[model samples]
Target: MKIFNAEKIKELDKLTIEKQQITSLDLMERAALQAFLWLVNHFQDKKTVYHIFCGDGNNGGDGLVIARLLKQNYFDVHVYIVPFNENFSIVFNSNLGRLKECNLEYEVISEATEFPNIGENHIIIDAIFGIGLTRELAGWIQKLIQKINYHQSFKVSIDVPSGLFLDKKTTIAIHSDVVLTFQFPKLAFYLPDNENFIAEIVLLPIDLDVKSIESIPSTYYYTDLNKIKKRYKPISKFSHKGTQGHALLIGGCFGKIGAMVLASQAALRSGCGLATVFVPKCGYEIMQTATPEAMVITDENYHKITNIEFNFQPKAIGIGMGIGQDDETTQAFHHFLKTIPFRW
Candidate 1:
């Protein structure tokens, strides 16, 4: 689940192609097939009209392959090629030729005016740009994306959304309903700055070389259920309450005793053998009433925490929940930190 940058993803693709001895076209076909399969699974109705917007790159090539597959399967598919410039990838041209061979007609959109009028019932597949997009889009292309966004159609972006940068924040990009990304999750998808443009991300694995993926260095990772399962350790049958870890939660003032109650309860639910809460004197009765399982200790002050005192060593300490930034509370917290023993 390592989240790699655009360059690292390209490197992984190159390594995968070299290790598997497959042509780039073969890889493109595999990626397109995965996307096609996803479409088939989600949109089973053959009457569903698909408006696939493709660029003059490999992402467009994937769109072309998907168009051909959908057409062959008797689906209502319409393909439109957005030629932003004269340059085009070889695989893209190859897929375009394959689409022509299937007698499936497609239109080339050169201007913003040439953009199609999409209905709300249609599914818009955006393959106009992928992870390779670095710079901001041109005015006309941005307008095209804006028009796509204006439609109330269910939009699914291929690979990454058009105009979205994997490594940096993007201002203008396709605001997709669902982004069907390949292999690893892009870093931009998880960032708060790009929250408006991103949507439900579905990872589609293309069988990239596993060793090559592991060899690449990445600082970010997307932890899934499989990863958690791998790291999960079952509890020993002979383990008792004392053998399990102890957790200490310290926070809460007069009116904010609920915070400590919830925290202590959460600690116990997380499988901690012992749950203890250190709060102001005013929170002692509330914590005991709300969370009967947790042991509570109260500071000398009633409205706020003036001191944090505990005898037994806790495996983990979680502090500062509802503790207001009062001068006395701040000084007490500082003194507590200074006096606390670090077992590790």
Candidate 2:
């Protein structure tokens, strides 16, 4: 899956709306429906109470739509509107109107004191903020997030955890057990800096325009089974050992022979036809004993790799597993790179 930044995601959304000839409201409904389906599928118990915290934005609109769907289906649902500011998105107000039409009541939390006590048995759906959040949250809203985080309830965030920025780092955000994001995975979700705020990220496809998604330029991608299957090649029945492929693993110093053994074993296990390891003299016996399936070549040096020599060319070479930074070893590696037939 192509991972897009915030601006690129907006661009993709705009392109999708234009190409599909659907109104933005229609798109929002699609997103809300997807999220609602996921919730219903996972939590089959209609008696379970769901407290949905929403903002005055499209993300909050998603929560409102979900609440309406749940209530209409006889599921117990409670909606809270957490307006970070007085301004409200047009679609949000539209969804709010729809909620009222269904005779479903909602509460607007104006202060931190108005925050309800979420029980551990209940489910909290966080829709207060999405990827568009650009500034750090503070004051009562931050306090509300902290209150939600303190609860042991199963928290599911919509699009992204509240207060999370897609293109930048944020100090405070909703720590969710699951994040049901729309269409593509956000780049911020994978950053180590934001790990504390995120858990299992579920991608909910809203049927955005595929042509537009592919047309958008992106350097990041989330590799899943589908991607792997697309690139996989089947082996022929007539194929032999030499027909597969040759892999060269070059590493291992004095006490790090285990590294080379594991590398060579992995090479063969990954369907490599031939596996070879080049190590120092000390590692020669250890590598041979541990990995009998691999072909081992030893360096002239005793404890380090000062020289690397191989006759036949390998289809791929993996180096620097456990190679130490000795002066001679470094110089030998440089020389070996210079002698390779291929350009770097």
Candidate 3:
């Protein structure tokens, strides 16, 4: 599925509104409804206490609606509005009044004086800052997220995590234990470095348009493994070892024969039909004892490589890990590189 940026998101939001013939409030309602539905499916109301923190944007509107719906369902819930600014958007104000009418446990923390103490056992619903957070959590709000992290409680971030940059705005993001994201996953949520930011997350579809969503452009993507699985081509049953390619690895100084062994091991594991390793004579016994599957050739010297007699055409050549920059070894490597020209 396609992920969007902050601008594209607004476009998609307006597109969804126009396409579905619903207002932005309707989108917020379904978003919160779906979030609450997920909560009901995963959690029971009999004894769970929920601490919901909301902002002044539509993200908080969703939180307020969740609070009201939970109350209507007779669940124990507390709503805390982390007041960044007093003037909330119209939908937020509307939901705020509705939550007030239900006499829900709601409080507005305008400053540090009104900050409420959250117990360690509580499930925190962080809506203080959602996907549109374009800047760093600055001043007192930065301190608030740090405090939230210190509590070490089971926290659930609504939409994207409270401080995530939705469309590559800022390079930073807040890590959430569980992110209940809407429609599609966030682009940052799938980054190799972002796994810590998002421990576990699930996409809650609220039905955005496919054509309009594709009309937008983005570089980052949420790599869905199931979708990738459909594109994987398995090995043909008639394939033979010779059909695979060979691999040549050059490395390993006097004492680091294990480097060449590891390279040969990886080459074999990656389905290389044949593998060869070139190292100093000091590593010959080591490689032979450790990995007998590899064919080995040694340079003339005992502890360093002066020259390498390259013969076989390998599909790939891997070099440099534990290879020391000795003069003779360096000369050999330079000669080898110039002898074998590669495109890229």
Indicate which candidate wins on lDDT: 2
Q: Write the per-residue lDDT of candidate 3 for residues 81-150, one digit (tens) a residue.
A: 8777658989999999898799986777754544567677767887777767776665667667766777
Show how many residue pairs clash in every candidate, following the order shown.
0, 0, 1
User: Could you give the candidate ranking by TM-score, starting with the highest?
Assistant: 2, 1, 3
Q: Write the per-residue lDDT of candidate 2 for residues 249-329, one digit (tens) a residue.
A: 999999988989888999999999999999999998898899988999988888999888888888999999899899999
Show where candidate 1 strays beyond 4 Å. 235-240, 326-344
TM-score of 3: 0.76
Task: Name the candidate, 2 or 3, with the larger lDDT value.
Answer: 2
lDDT against true structure, model 2? 0.90
Query: Please, what is the TM-score per model?
Result: 0.89, 0.93, 0.76
Output the better candidate (1/2) by lDDT. Answer: 2
Show the colliding residue pairs in model 3.
Answer: 175-197
Maximum-TM-score candidate: 2
Q: Candidate 3, which ten residues in sequence have the lowest lDDT sum?
A: 166-175
